[model samples]
Target: MTGGREGRVAVTMPQLGETVAEGTVLRWLKQVGEAVADQEPLLEISTDKVDAEVPSPAAGVLAEIVVGEDETVDVGTVLAHVAPGAPSPGQRAEATGAPPVEPAAEERSPSPPSGERSSPPAGGPRHRHSPRVRRLAHDSGVDLASLTGTGPAGRVTPDDVERAARHAAPEPVPSPEAPVSVPTRAAPQRVSTAAATEPLPSLARSSAPAANRAFRTLVAEVDVPAAQWVGSSDQASVPVPGSAAAAVVAAVAGALRSHPSLLAPGAGADAGDLAVSWSTGSGTTSCLLSQAGELNVGGVAQRLLAGATAGEPPPGAGFTVSLLQDTDVLFEVAEPPPGQVATIVFGTPTRRVVVVDADGSPGIAIRQRSSVALSHDPGTVSREAALAFLRDVVRRAHSRA
Candidate 1:
């Protein structure tokens, strides 16, 4: 290990938000003595609202594991340390202040708690395991301290937990009236008796049905000549205020203003109207419940992008629009989250824009071609209203352009 604080870099728990003072270490991508790159995903942290992959601050060898898996620690707490390069097992032990103790000769066989690989010493460091393994152990009522790990460096794995569980379980006692060996043809009778004696599956414990969604889809193509822009032609060199997403958002918002009934009154209303908001970047399909009845498309678009970038939920919008820049794929289907009126997914140009020549010849033209999908609550917004809303958006887009 490198000397002093010169080579060692402390890996601290980050402050995700003003309210989030602590977070749980969900998983570590690199183990002790492993090399890691700067900005690479080092570990996963789970907060109340988001699960994020925390990136490494600098490229180095993971030298120490301070905070164990599933351990919750306050923000700025040092989770681990990184050195300049990888260290040998002996060197690692020396660096971490751990005594270098080898397994006894009798512990050669690879079995849980067998031979010299029994439980750790009373005051010695406990065997290191992953968050997943610890969680499994907890749920299965297996004692981590009692089981010998089979993973590298004797770290407890999920497999070790499972094996411990099997060993810890009590065997079922045989009934006084045991049945004699049954012929192959009579196996069904034995199975029937076993089934009859077995307890039925707990209905209440079973997973519930998927939540209901009022889904609606609208597919339309609007012609947008390359010249369609909001800025003055004199300032042609300057970038336009409207991106493909922003323009669509503004158009939708303006159209919704015409039909105010489509806008929801508040969040969490089962059958209320919905407001429209647009999203930036690619991610899981989601709706931001918005209460802004009359909204500025440009401002709302900026806010949506900023909020998503910060890993915060967008303001309440009855319908959320996600603009996907990835154009390689031609089509996709997305559903709205429950409690929202709808989620609109707008795709980049897919189909070609063309113009008919006066001589009846067809030629390709430069235009923006988008595929729009609206997943709406059928109970609150009818299919006809959804289609009309989409048409109005196209009209607005054309008029603005």
Candidate 2:
């Protein structure tokens, strides 16, 4: 936060992450002259990694907006200004350098006499409507003042305008020469009790066919001891149980940063500014990290834990990592959701006998290992690229271990 002219305080674009240098203003939750509470969501912003709501730094009236919606600015740039105290309407107008607005006709000192014509109410719906909503109403030929507002504080929302426009749309008249046919109703089919009793397949299961058509899966084995060591070591930033998961996440993040080709076309332009979805027992959460490629195992763990705890997932993640620990399943091909490019599934680690190279010869030894599988969209990512990425993830994980 910075200081503004007069007694107003400046709200600048915050540095969201280590690698993020800029952000785009998405929307203003509070317009100029509106009183906002401290920590209240003031606006929405979009960066390469994630979209988030920025909160007000102090309780005050929003004095001015220096940055408009959709404008991109560098970090630390002043975005707006907020006056220190709750000002009256006239004071707000003066602080914003705008002329004081007159009261609505209904609230005027003297009402229009003898049916004399009076101007429309100053506080009509248009006054409270956002620029976007007003534009939409104008384009859709909807009357703003007549519609009942369903939004907060009786504000006319875009949806309400759209709904009114749809309802007011003129019906087409049929020509006399055109033949009209009566529509016949079809009989409803009866469902058998057994069929109805059968459990419905989950959304992922039902979409498997379509997702499989464009996706490819690759599986690899990782040394579980290395991951466990990183997880339990003092260097680990997250809890012991989640340390391994963090290691995997860090590896994936590094791989994505190193090989942008692994991501869908437009998704890679941001380079290291990437966000990944993490699926755990609680739910899937989108985690955004700063300089993920340079972050140590602990740093990755901390970010993942924070995101999971927040519960509210940010949008625009093309890659996902799912943890399926504590299960016997060696590896499972997890399908990516719509708009997602790929998913990595980690299986439970288990002790297994494997050939170990000792001094000068190979010998049988017991070791902990886990199966990891990568499910990616073949249409966007080639098999070779996917395999290379998977290999890179394993290599990075081992490097940290």
Candidate 3:
């Protein structure tokens, strides 16, 4: 399409990490001939660690669907292609020698051997090898024909074998020392498993215990002073070594560092509940785990946002047990002015939502008039003075509303 990839953007499956071996195609949201935008989800993919939505790297007509659903492919495979604002095939008569095919029709097209839509010749499937896969084969000087089956329906396994067979591959000729072997240890091979963690102390902080039923929700929120907002005061001359969010993360990380306490109650030990909350300029989150010996519910929002914004995730942030702290929060749901929650992590106004896409992130505007300097040596103010500040703001805001 588009004359050999000119102006085309490649939507490749991300290689999350070295330990991450490969992924499976669970489904495709968009398909060939579909109109798509940059960063829009093109397909749903699953790796060992996650079930993730694969986004288009750029906007264009989803020019081609290179991989099939339920197919497993290695990282860096080009799952789909997007050209810069290219019209659907129907609109651009010159591309693909055909017009834009309807998105719904193409996406629902069944996988090969069923022959619903047009089928490639019996010798091979129309869509099989990914563009990146082809490139890698060429670069590694691999003969795909020689590779044996590992993937679905005899599809060639990628990368791991490619890299291994290419780099650390057995040389055409070998040295004698390479065949040396060590004696096996004289012990039985044992498989060990660690138990699931006990609930966090903060999760247990609820005064009223919620019943475990079919489904439910929990809610919490926090406030921020305008002066401490991210954009406040040109945000210091130099980048601070740590963000306010990072501080919150550090506090929570500290909680988990007490591994024995975090582990669930077992082996005759009695556990108590611990309640901790984290808050930062980014947002606020509360944690309640019913366990004994710690209640570190401090700066949860700060902990999460710091980890999210840190550009790298901290330990324990990846678990489902971990949750986001909402920055621009709205407890009451409404329509239009405050749109419905998007299916996935999406940004918003009013409440700065980092979306669940990332681990971390802030809010609220407080006026200088609401606060006053303390006169005593210890820098403390009287209770009556604090009440006046709260009542005054309530009156000011109520009058405005």
Clashes (N, CA, C under 3 Å) per candidate = 10, 1, 43
Q: How do all models score by TM-score?
A: 0.36, 0.42, 0.26
**Candidate 1 C-alpha lDDT tens digits along 1-401:** 33336668888888888899899998786666555667666788988767787877777556777887899999889888877553455545645565434443234221222323244456354466688776556544567888777888788887787566444543233232332221222211100111012211111111223453324455555544343222222433322224445566666666665443244434322322333322223222223424323446556445334333312224444555555444553322344543455555555554464464746877666556655655455455555456667677778766644
Write out the backbone clash pairs for model 1.
Answer: 216-376, 263-273, 264-273, 264-274, 275-318, 288-317, 289-316, 289-317, 290-316, 290-317
* Model 2 Cα lDDT, one tens digit per residue, 242-313: 666677777888777645545544564244344544333444344565566677778877766564432323
Deviation in angstroms for 271 in model 2? 4.4
- Higher-TM-score candidate among 1 and 3? 1
lDDT for model 2: 0.60
Best by lDDT: 2
Better of 2 and 3 by lDDT: 2
Q: Give the alpha-carbon lDDT of every model.
A: 0.52, 0.60, 0.36
Distance (Å) between predicted and true CA of 188, model 3?
A: 38
Q: Could you give candidate 3's per-residue lDDT for residues 1-401 as a string of tens digits?
A: 42237777777778766688788887777656656666766778889988787877776667766778998888988776666664544534444456445444344322222343234335433346766555445433455555554776555666433443323232231111221111122121111111111211221122223221111111112222222222222343312112332222222233222221122223111232222232334333333333322323234333322323311112221111222233332221101001110000100112222223233433333321111111110012122222232233233322322
Best by TM-score: 2
Show the lowest summed lDDT stretch of 10 residues, model 1: 187-196
